[model samples]
Target: MRVVSLVPSLTEAVAATAPGLLVGATAWCTHPAGLDAVRIGGTKNPDVPAITALAPDLVIANEEENREPDLTALRAAGIEVLVTEVRTLEQAFSELERVLVHACGLDRPRWLDEAGTAWWDLPAPPEASRAVVPIWRRPWMVLGRDTFAGDVLSRLGVENLYAGHADRYPRVPVDDLCAAAPDLVVLPDEPYVFTADDGPEAFPGLPSALVSGRHLTWYGPSLAEAPAVLGAALRAARP
Candidate 1:
């Protein structure tokens, strides 16, 4: 079965499960490292004509990363597009199964099973830390309500300060976030490339836990290591 994936995590999933099945992927689909596939484009701006030209049996996309009009065009072109909505860890697993097992008609990948075990075995700290997770710096966007990263952090006892905020990813003034006075500031390396010198300086005295964006936000084989990887980073946070 030939497949084209627009979402990076889904691209990694398809590639890891059956690399030969994936004939095309987005330019940002940079996982399973050296994936040999036709570059369709970015998640928000996939090349519809280029994708259509690939003539794959299936195309995978995410509700959050992809644009609706692109999906509509693919369907209009008679291509089978499987759209996944994964806002939580559990949802990620279910969606992975749906896309890989049901949509692609392939056996469940062993890595996914291992990921379930990884998350299930995590020991949630009784006293969770309040944290403001910043995804981007310019205009300062943060993880808000109904986000996959927030849900993952919640499981690991890192409470998101804006978890109840109206927007999923809210752009706030850096000053306003500092006023929230979170126990720590969780920073991921993607979408903004926040680093020791870059993001930590924004929150003067607050502890900053720099984390892998893939493990923090992505829902793929990385799930197998997210629990342990993110857990350690969150725990080691110092004020």
Candidate 2:
């Protein structure tokens, strides 16, 4: 079955499972390096006409990374679109299974099984740390309530300062974020690229952990390495 994926994580998942099945993907879908799929466009503004031209049997998308109007447009073009909403680790696994077994009609990838075992078998950290995780700068956007990344951090015993906020991704002042008295500040390198030298200075007295955005944010094969990858980074941000 021919497939086109709009989400980078999903693209990687599908490509890893069966590279030949992926005929097209978004320009942002850069994973499993040297992927030979046709570039459709960005997640927010995919080239629907170009995608429809591919005549894929299935198109994979994510609720958070993609817009509804685009998905509707794809459906309007008579393309079978599979939209996934993954807000938690469990949901991520379940959705991926659905996409692979149900949508693409392929055998489950071994990496996915390893990922589930890695996450579920992890022993919770004994000490919890309070932190401010900033996704973007300039205007400053933070992870808020009910977000997948927030849930992942919670599992590692790190409390996000704005997790109780009404907005899923809240734009807040950097000064106020510091004033919250979080023991540490966590920064990821995607959506906004925060490096070790660049991000640490903003926190002043607070220790900052510059983490891998792919591992912390994306759900796919990376989920298997997240427990160890994020754990080491968060471990350095202690009081």
Candidate 3:
């Protein structure tokens, strides 16, 4: 079946489930390397004409990734749009399974359930008591309560320093970060690629680690591999 993916995360999911089935994708969908697919456009502004030209049997999008206007336009064109809103890790897994079911006509729940169980079985990472996870730079955005990345850090025994803050991706002041004085600071590699050099200068007194952004933040089938990978990374970084 011909499929078009407007969301980057869902593009990764589709490639994982049915690699060659993705006929079209957004320019940002670069997860599964070697996917020579058509770039229809971005999440917010998809090339409607290019997508229509592809004549895909299905188009996948995410509520957070694609704007309502874009979805409305696609729907108005009578395109079968599968919109998913993935917040928590469980929701991400569910969305991935749903995509697989729709794209490949496969029973994805069985495999997803098994993977979920395995993820739950892994031992919890050491609790750092207080921690801050930075997913973006420039303006400096952080994960807040109820977010999948926040939930993942919680599972690792790291309490979000800004969990009770009003915003999900709050712009924290450098002084505020210093005041929080977290035991650990997590620097994700995507959205913002923070290196060891970026750490010492920005956070002079904190112990920081550059982590795999996808493993810690991307809440899809990747979660199965994340718990172990993240747990090990955090453990190794501990003082």
Candidate 4:
């Protein structure tokens, strides 16, 4: 079945589950590379005409990625639309299972079970007891509260310093980050591409490291392989 994915994470899911089935996708959908398929548009503003012209059998999107108006329009157009909303690890796994079931018409893969096993088996990072994972720079946005990233950190036995905050993705002053002074600072490698060179000069004494944004931040089938990568990164950043 031909598919058009408007959400980046769903794009990754579809590609992983059924590769060549994707006929169109957004520019931001860059997982499972070599998907030179049609560029629908961005997350917020998909090229409706272009997508309509593709006439895909299914169009996948995310509640967080696409705007309501566009989703409404797509639904009005009578396109079979599947929307995914992933806020926690359980939600992520559910979304993955849903996508796999929809795309392949089968039961959820054993990968999910294996992923759970890997997560449960890993020894919690000692120094990561209190950590803050920064996903963006510029205005300094962070994964806050009960977000998927926060849940992943929690499962690894790491405490998210911002998990106490009310906002899910909060933009705070660098001074606030300095004040939190977490045991470890996790700088994700996308959105803002924070690297070790960026350092923690703002926090002075915190140990920091650059981590894979896709592994730590994305919520999809990729989660199956993320724990090990995150575990090693957290271990290396231990104070």
Candidate 5:
């Protein structure tokens, strides 16, 4: 079956599970490097006409990563779109299963089980550290309540300061974030690339943990190594 994926994580998952099933994907779907799928466009503003023209049997998307209008347009074109909502780690596993087995009609990939085992095997973290996780910096948007990244950090013992906020990704002033006084500043390198020289300077007093955005944000094969990678970064940033 031919598939076009708007989500990078889902694209990687599908690509890893069943090669050649992906006929098209967003330009951001950079995982499993050297992927040969046709580039549709970015997740938020995908080329609808181009995607419909691909004549894919299935178009996979995510509720948070994709726009409603784009999904509507794809559906209007009579394309079978599978939209997955993943607010927590468990939901991610379930959705991955649904997408591969139910949507693509393939057996569950071994990597899925390995990813689950990787997280489940982790020992409970010692007292959790409070942190402000900034995904973007032009206006300073942070991971707020019910976010997949927030849940991932929680598992790694880094509590998100903005997790109580009403909006999932809340934009806060830089001064306000500094004033909140988190123990650490967790920076992911995607949506915005926060380098050691670039992002750490903003939080002068606090230790900043620069992390891999794919491992921290994307719910795919990278998940198998996320716990170790994020945990090490968080630990290195600790005083």
Candidate 6:
């Protein structure tokens, strides 16, 4: 079954589970190191014509990572599009199964079970640290309200300050973020590439945890290592 994945996490999941099933993927699907699929542009703006030409049996995407218009266009071209919505870790596991097992007709991979076990076995921190997680700068958007990233951080004992905001990814002024007075700043290296020199200076005296965006955000095989990876980064910042 030929598949075109617009979501990076799902791309890694499919590529790792069943090699060569993906005929096309977004340029941002960078996991598994050396993937050899046709590039179909980025997640927000996939090249509809280029994807249609690929004639994939399935195109897997996320409701948040992908744009609605692109999914509509793909469906208009009679392409079967599997759109996933993952707001929590459990939801992520379920969605991964939906895409790989139900949609692709592949047996449930062992990594999926191991990932679940890994998270389940994690020892929760004695106290959760309130955190402000910025996904982007300039306009300053943060992980707000029911996000997969927020859930991931929560599992690692870092609570998102904007998790109750009405918008999923809300644009707030940097001043407002600083005023929130989070215990620490959790910076992921994607969507904006917040580096050690770049992001931490904004919050004086506050420990900034520079984390792997793949482990912090993506919900594929990385799930197995996220608890240890994120926990270490969080521990380093707090220590």
| Model 4 per-residue lDDT tens digits across residues 111-194 | 677876776677755544787777777788887877777888788768888887889889988878878867778888877877
Q: Write the per-residue lDDT of candidate 5 for residues 58-159, one digit (tens) a residue.
A: 999999899999999999999999999999999999999999999999998999999999999999996888999999988899999999999999998988
Give the best candidate by lDDT: 5
- In terms of lDDT, model 5 sits at 0.94
Off by over 4 Å in 4: 103-107, 123-128
Which 10-residue span in candidate 1 carries the lowest summed lDDT? 120-129
Looking at candidate 3, the ten consecutive residues that score lowest on lDDT are: 106-115
Task: Give a tens-digit lDDT track for model 3, residues 76-123.
Answer: 888888888777767877778778885558657444666688677867
Cα misplacement distance, residue 132 of candidate 4 (Å): 2.1
**Backbone clashes, each candidate:** 0, 0, 0, 0, 0, 0
Q: Please say which candidate is ahead in lDDT: 2 or 5.
A: 5
lDDT for each candidate structure: 0.91, 0.91, 0.78, 0.78, 0.94, 0.92
Ranking of models by lDDT: 5, 6, 1, 2, 4, 3
Per-residue lDDT for 198 in model 5? 90
lDDT of 2 by residue, 38-129 (tens): 99999999999999999999999999999999999999999999999989999999999999998888888899999999999989675778
lDDT of 6 by residue, 1-239 (tens): 99999999999999989978999999999888889899999999899999999999999999889999999999999999999999899999999999999999999999999999999988867488899999999989999999999998887788899999999999988889999989999999988999999988988888999999999889999999999988889999983
Deviation of model 1 at 109, angstroms: 1.3
Judge candidate 6 at residue 51 and give its lDDT: 97
Candidate 2: where are CA atoms >4 Å away? none
Q: Rate residue 203 of model 5 by lDDT.
A: 92
